[model samples]
Target: MRTSRPWMTQAATRTTAVHIHHQTNDTTWRSYMTIRRAWPCLVFGAACLCPLPIQAQSYPERSIRMIVAFATGASHILAIALSEKLRESLGQGVVPDFRPGAGGNLASALAAKAPTDGYTLLLTSPTIAISPSLFKNLGYDTFRDFTPISLLATVPNVLVVHPSVPAKSLKELIALAKAHPHKLNFGSGGVGSGSQLGSELFKALAKIDIVHVPYKGASIALTAMLGGEVDMVVSTVPATIPFINSGRMRGLAVLAPERVASLPKVPTTAEAGMPQVVVITWYGMFTRAGVKPEIVERLNTEIVKALRMPDIRASFAKVGLDTAPTTSAEFARFLREETDKWARVIRDADIRVN
Candidate 1:
């Protein structure tokens, strides 16, 4: 890591120059004598004050690019909302690039290759954690390729079905699947995506075999479910809430540990008797590995602050994302745990991208 900052040297030189001129002044000399008498305490205070210039100038000197590992629209609606808040708070432009393919492996690799100057970031979910085990040849390693920044939110997936489906509850759905194994199909954003994992976990816990139908994106997947192309879809509540309310889709159960505020009537997967299928989509921020620890801390603090804002909180709630922030270290540990947990699910369910 680079130990010296050019900006800090410039600021310190300016401070020292201004003080040198003041040394000749009578009033300044008297003040200097008083400070020198208390030099031990005064020096510590002075050094603390001197470092602000470097910190202010070094971070985000230019616009930042945040790569979203999903397509445009509902899949990334929450990310764009959070990015807008971050831009307002940091006073730097924030640009988002949505790269959708290979279950976000393409975007993750692109971010891993970018410079680790804090100018580039990745906005994504646990798929970054889950992909390494699912694909035989993923380009980048999640733990090795990036530094975990902060956790943005935990989005719960809802088990939604087309109104035409005979099953009205999770219990009934499982029974129906048991009666006709491999006949029911579940639509997902794509293979190895969070929706896929949610559905996979569901199948594992329920002891059922629902055919997986991977679509290009969430919209298409939801379209398939609504058109009866697929029997059910395990997706985020925000994307399916409108349809559920409109009677186009019915909520069989939520994959969250607890029922969501928006859908108080619906039961969680555990409440519906399958306690092992609890899965929620969690999004976290990341920068390429090798970014300074101080830079990571600064970004994390700002992001947490941005998420706490009333408008930002409301915007997140509007889209069914709970505004919860986790420290970088905490998020890193969580990522590892989630990766291990999902890896077991993928293996147990015999899930694979190809």
Candidate 2:
């Protein structure tokens, strides 16, 4: 309206072009930022869909700690052998850390509190199944806090008496106990040990009254029996094998379904007229609950493979143990049955521990 100058017209046109350029740049930058923010979400969704195999493949990044329930005896032997085999296959060190007390509860408690990661493993005996019934307070729930990996091995418990006892057979021992109710005494690893429970089950089944003398461990109890400090002991075949062979102790009967090769002369409880008196000391592997299924499967596979190896089997066999590997589901079912059976025995025998 004022003046139609060439310079003014040119200036207005240039201003319009600059405004358009700024608008275009702002729109492009917003689109880029939206994509950048969404990148992590897209990756997370993909991972959720296929996580198991990847997690398993990447697992066991470091050495694993195997908590041995007992420092000595068949459990320790099995642990060392199994750990060696696992180390070879898994390419990670499987170290045995002995925590022997409370009839295996100390190790169980420590294992139960460990992270749900696959790095911590527990190697235990039937005490795991027995503790729930024998103890008033436990730190972990057997079924809730643990995931069974596999049943590694089983050793037969033999009722062995010192050389001084006159009884030669299971029946003779029962009659002798009947003649003198509290004269004959039995030694055990501890109050709630498998040896004690096995002996209690025997007492309940045979209707005999024998005093129970608790020792720090089964080996100690066996030592006591050897020294004639205790009359008899329900001990593992391996611990009593040398003594029996050397005439230091007499094997009354083996508490198993079949007689062990190491003690072939020893009669099974079934064969000894007490079919209900079978007590097997078993070793199994477990990890804290909530571990990935893939990791569990991996461990189960490796254990099964290791147990099948001839050398491993031979090593265990030499010590009176049978390599009894089983799948996770099978072991879990077996554990449940063992727990129920021991619970009944504990309740009937009135066994209690603080």
Q: Highest TM-score among the candidates is held by which one?
A: 2
Candidate 1: the clashing residue pairs are none
Lowest summed lDDT across 10 adjacent residues in model 1 is found at 3-12
Give Cα-based local distance difference scores for all models.
Answer: 0.73, 0.78
Q: Please give the lDDT score for candidate 1.
A: 0.73
State the lDDT of candidate 1 residue by residue for 132-217, as single tens digits: 88877778889888999877777777899888889989999999999999999999888777788778777766678889999987
TM-score of each: 0.76, 0.79
Please report the TM-score between candidate 1 and the true structure: 0.76
Give the per-residue lDDT of model 2 (tens digit) for 258-331: 56677778887767787656677788999989998889977987888798789997887777777776667767
